[model samples]
Target: MTSYYDQRGVGLIEVMVAILLLSIAVLGFSALQMRAINATDESLVRTKSLTLVRNLSEIMRAYPNAYVTGSATSFTTASPTATGAVSTVQAVMSSSATSTVTVDAKTIDITTSANGCLSTGTKQETVDSIVKTVPAQHCNMSQLAARDTLMAKKIAKDEDISMTVVTCPGTTTQAIQTQMCVIAAWNDTKAILSDSDANACATSNGVYKTDSHCLISEAY
Candidate 1:
């Protein structure tokens, strides 16, 4: 016959084991949740990078800069600065007194001074009929390239990522054309600049680093 004292603390041992198992399960769930969150954040950054890289590419094309016409790969590290978020206003940016233009993806009423430039004076109205003060970047020839880089810089800053518009060093002189590489790096300790000897995000030779959290998109 077993004594009651012999079974004393046996139930306590079982309870302790159960508590440990529960703790382990809770820890595992928390880890999984954290992993999911990190993955989601990475995905979001990548998506933004894609849009922004393409956006910069279009801006470069619209501006027709030296990189597009040089026919030889060159390095450009001009990180322009600007004030607010850039609207996705993909317009021809013409200057006219009374005309309609797109603002933040919405067509709006545009009016400017007789000189026909936003730098002089401009007005913008949204489609909702609510008149808000926003200038149209039209006919700013001297600042077109500046504005392009500024837009790229501001958007990248807002997205909490580092980026640049550098030449995608063409390897072959015949088949490979002089291309611009839009590089974006996230969770990186420093800006993703061209490093000829280091394994970087889109190396100086246009090779992308596999172990780094970076992306490279070509725009020619």
Candidate 2:
């Protein structure tokens, strides 16, 4: 049998090895915790983006007719009074993450007011008929544009969004303008879509409408 002192020294070496192994295990656990936190943050950002899209879509659908026939007189872009128009959808995304959101508007503008009359014809002379096209961009184009800018700001706390109103041929009779879909997308290089391609998803009202197709990748 070796001396007791020799056995004591072996026990100390064993203890040292155990301590080193325990430290490595603790570091592994800490790393996993950090990864979990990062994943949670990314998930939250994605959820906010989806929610922002749905919320804006709901607003559009809620007032579908307004988008088409929004009168300059009735429209107020300076300070919107619509419920959930200001704070709810945008504040969450802007405040919660480093993400950026943008919205773009497309319009079909018709030029040259035309003329038409009721089938009866007995009621009156040729009446000027102007049917504003869908995706309207009216005299209030500036206001509408400004509103979109504000909306972008409210949504992303940044004015990185864009809106474009394009002119198109109207119905057989009168000139009309229309405001189409509003697209919300993150400005990240990794983001799948952009505003220019938003209209590709919509039905063609006429040759007059702008190209609005979204080139969504298969990876999405």
RMSD list, candidates in order: 12.2, 16.2
lDDT tens string, model 1, 49-128?
Answer: 88887887777666542221111111122112222211112112112211433222223333333322335455675647
Model 1 TM-score is: 0.60
- TM-scores of the models, in the given order? 0.60, 0.39
Superposed Cα deviation of residue 107, candidate 2 (Å): 18
- Candidate 1: segments with Cα more than 4 A from true spot: 65-142, 171-177, 189-199
Best by lDDT: 1
The sequence of per-residue lDDT tens digits that candidate 2 reaches over residues 1-220 is 5686567778779999999999999999999999999778656654565555454544433432222212322222222344423222222122221222212232212111111111222222232674434322232433333333334335633433222222222323212122323333333322122234343332333221233222111100
Distance from true position, residue 69, model 1, in Å? 13
Q: How many backbone clashes does candidate 1 have?
A: 0
lDDT of each: 0.52, 0.34
What is the Å distance of residue 11 in model 2 from its true position?
A: 2.1
* Per-structure clash totals for the candidates: 0, 14
